[model samples]
Target: MDARQRLIETTRELLHERGYVGTSPRAVQERAGVGQGSMYHHFAGKADLARTALERTAALERERAEALLGDASVPPADRVVAYLRRERDALRGCPVGRHTQDPDVLADDGLRSPVEQTFAWLRQRIAGLLAQAQQEGSLRAEADPAAVAAAVAAVVQGGYVLARAAASPEPAAAAADGAVAMLEALRTPPRAPHRA
Candidate 1:
């Protein structure tokens, strides 16, 4: 791959493994196998490169989500579960969540806007799906779909953090699966009393 592509991929790998706080420009350069000059030529600095890399990561994630989301022939609950169970290259954390935890990134408007936008976008998309579920009568109507969407986002993100800290996938998967199961349980027959 070209130097720019290499640099972005290296940045993404480091960010996922080390987080924005732990990743260093030197580490990124070394990982990309590019000289300092080549790296600089492609990006203004670590922050710039990180922004680009993060945007790419968010785009990829959204695309993955959209694929499952658009396939309406599939059952709604199945789609929700499949979206959560989708195989991830690194199951440790959400790229958007990673950016949110970075104090430096949060402090810089230029650096953080995309990160904020990423979550806002994902949350909105989740809300839309929840609305669809509600309209389809697969999800209960009492619970605010936005609130439930936020909760779902929390499970996925919190699961990632727990997975990384615990150094295992079990915790994350359980939490993620449990959240979806809880939502699945919300489904009820029209005559059945709905549960939130």
Candidate 2:
């Protein structure tokens, strides 16, 4: 890759492996195999490089989510299940969600905006899918789409934490299974046929 691309990719990896506080400009330059001049030429400084990398990471995550959640051929509930069960490196934690714990990233509005906006969009998108399912009589009428969406989002992030803490992927898998089971319970029962 080019110098600019290498710098961004290296910063992205560093940010994921180490939070903003730990990813020094020198480390980025060394890892990227680019000179100090190359990095400064492309980005004003470390924060600038981090922000750019973070924005790219956020966009990639959103795109991946959209692929599963936006498939019209699949049932809405199934779409949600697909998202929950999507392959993840539970032990490694989420690329974007991990940033929520970073003080430096949270403190800077510029750094935080992409992370905040990505999650908001995820919840909103999931809620829309749930609402659609409710309208189609697939989901229970009494179920609240927005509330369920938030819970779904929570479960995924929580699952990651649980997995990381336990040093096992089973917790994340179990959490996803539990979420799918809950969704199954919320599905509307089919009507009995009328006697002739």
Candidate 3:
């Protein structure tokens, strides 16, 4: 990889493993195997490098979510279930969700923008899927797509938090299973015609 790409990729990994506060320029340089001059040449400083890395992470997340949720061949409700149950590094926590806990990152818009945007996009995407499912009669008529979408997003993040705190992946797996069960409950058959 080129010097700049190396710096960004390394910074992305470091930022995921260590929040903004914990990741340092020296650490990024060491991980990237790039000299101070090369690092500075590509990025003005740590903040610049972090912003680039965070943007890459956000873009990747958006791409994956779009590919899964936007697939035309899969039923909308099935897409939601698939996304919720997809394999994740639960004990390590969400790479994007972890950023919200860092005061340093929250203090700077450059760093926080991607984290905020990613969740916002996810919630909207999930809501869209739910609405489509409802229109298709997969989801019950009374189920509120927006509210359910928020809860679904919460389940994933909460699962990560619980797993990280407990130092086990089981909690995360259970949370995801529970979410799927709840979503399944939302499904209902179309009503039968009334007899005259």
Candidate 4:
């Protein structure tokens, strides 16, 4: 890859692994195999490079989510389950979700914008799927789509945290499975006929 591309990709990985404070410009340059002059030639500084990388990460995240959740051919309820069960590296944690814990990234709008928008989009998409499930009678009419969606998001994010804290992927898997089970419970079962 080119210097600019290498810098961006390296920054994204570092940001995901080390958070803002942990990822130094020197580290980025060394990892990217680029000299200070090369990095400076491509971008203004760390903030500029980080902004570009974060935006790229968010876009990729949205595209992957939309592929599963936005698929019209799949049943809305199935789509929700598919997304929750999607394979991911739990120990590694979420690239975007991890940003919320970074004080530096949280303090800067330029750095935080992509992270904020990515989560907002994810929650909104889940809410839409739940709403569709309700409309189709797949989900219980009494369940609020927005609240359920928030819970679902929480389960996934919290799963990452659990996994990282335990230093094992099992907790994350269990969390996901539990979330799926809750969603299964939300399904409206056929009612038995009343005995007159």
Candidate 4 Cα deviation (angstroms), residue 66: 1.8
* Top of the candidates by TM-score: 2
- Residue-wise C-alpha lDDT for candidate 4, range 71-139, written one tens digit per residue: 899999789899899998999989788888999999999999999999888888999989999899889
Candidate 2 error regions (>4 Å): 193-196
- lDDT of each residue in 24-123, candidate 1, tens digit only: 9889888888999999998998889988888888788788787986688987656767777776533556766777787877888877887777678767
| Cα lDDT listed for each candidate | 0.79, 0.95, 0.90, 0.91
Q: Residues 1-196, candidate 3, lDDT per residue (tens digit)? A: 9999999999999988878878889898898899999999888899999999999988997887787888889999899898898889998778788888889889999999999999998998999999999898889989998899999899999999999999999999999999999999999866799999
Order by TM-score, highest first: 2, 3, 4, 1
lDDT score at residue 12, model 1, on the 0-100 scale: 88
Best by lDDT: 2
What is the per-residue lDDT of model 2 for residues 1-196, given as tens digits with 9 covering 90 to 100? 9999999999999999999999999999999999999899999999899999999999999999999999999999899999999999999999999999999999999999999999999999999999999999999999999999998999999999999999999999999999999899999998788999
Model 2 has an lDDT value of 0.95
lDDT of 1 at 10: 92
TM-score between model 3 and native: 0.93
